[model samples]
Target: MENIFFPKVVQAVAGENRTVYAYMNDGSIRLVDMKPMIKQGGIFSQLEKDTFFEERLTVLNDTVAWDLTGEHDPTQCIDIDPFTVAECPAVADPLEIVG
Candidate 1:
């Protein structure tokens, strides 16, 4: 039998230029650029508003999400798959880089 690993996102921080830093349970940080998705519009259109992307960014359903309702309702949030987030390239902590 083979063991399957499912990546779990524990925390998320929105970054400049529509990027998100996803902190995984395995202690790895993944950088996800949301510009492309947001540019496509549709459900992502709401995120285009100023500061909304960053303000609503959160961790929901064990993945990176945007709490559109501001009530932390997982059902009302927009979320990215953990596997997809895990596939993104790793980056050094932004705070550490700036410090």
Candidate 2:
């Protein structure tokens, strides 16, 4: 989780893109998915539709600094692109996104 949730807090720049982390139910922070995206595919399409999160943590005395990510990320676990996530974010996270 240290790598995901416990990272140092950062600010969102108007013209900058950076890594934002999320916390899992396992008391661990999820890892970043640096994989490239698929241009055209059903899974890819879904990722493009989900809402991703942008969150901040309480820096008082927490073990790992993580809270609910702001938006949603459909592609978080699936093998697809961010666009698929942008489509449907409210759906529960699945352990596997494959058929």
Candidate 3:
């Protein structure tokens, strides 16, 4: 989840014409546009599509051993659970928050 900021950043580099809606886990709101993040991959691929259907995401930032499993070092990951997250106030935050 990364506090919705990642999406905003991604959109800025991906789709300049698209609109951004930043929703905090606590229900706070923020708006942004996609005009600065596109060439680096936007909603088409780097977009965060967390909506229940997608789950079990991970964020690996440790450059040394990677994750506890000693596998690939994932920079970021968003566990999707739109329904439950939207419903449960305490479960809307990102799963793996290394930063």
My TM-score estimates for the predictions, one after another, are 0.92, 0.23, 0.24
- Clash statistics: count for each candidate: 0, 23, 11
Tens-digit lDDT track of model 3 for 9-79 = 11101112442333533443333332233344533333333321122222223111112233433533322
Ranking by TM-score: 1, 3, 2
Candidates 1 and 3 compared: the better one by lDDT is 1
**lDDT by residue for model 1 (1-99), tens:** 999999999999988888999999999999999988888988888888757888898999999999989999999999998999999999887767563
Candidate 3: RMSD over Cα atoms?
14.0
Q: What is the C-alpha RMSD of each candidate to the true structure, in Å?
A: 1.4, 15.5, 14.0
Question: lDDT for model 3, on a 0 to 1 scale?
Answer: 0.28
lDDT against the true structure, per candidate, is 0.91, 0.28, 0.28
Per-residue lDDT of 18 in model 3: 40
Off by over 4 Å in 1: 97-99
List of clashing residue pairs for candidate 1? none
Instruction: In model 3, state the lDDT of residue 51.
Output: 26
Superposed by TM-score, candidate 3 places the C-alpha of residue 79 at a distance from the truth, in angstroms, of 12
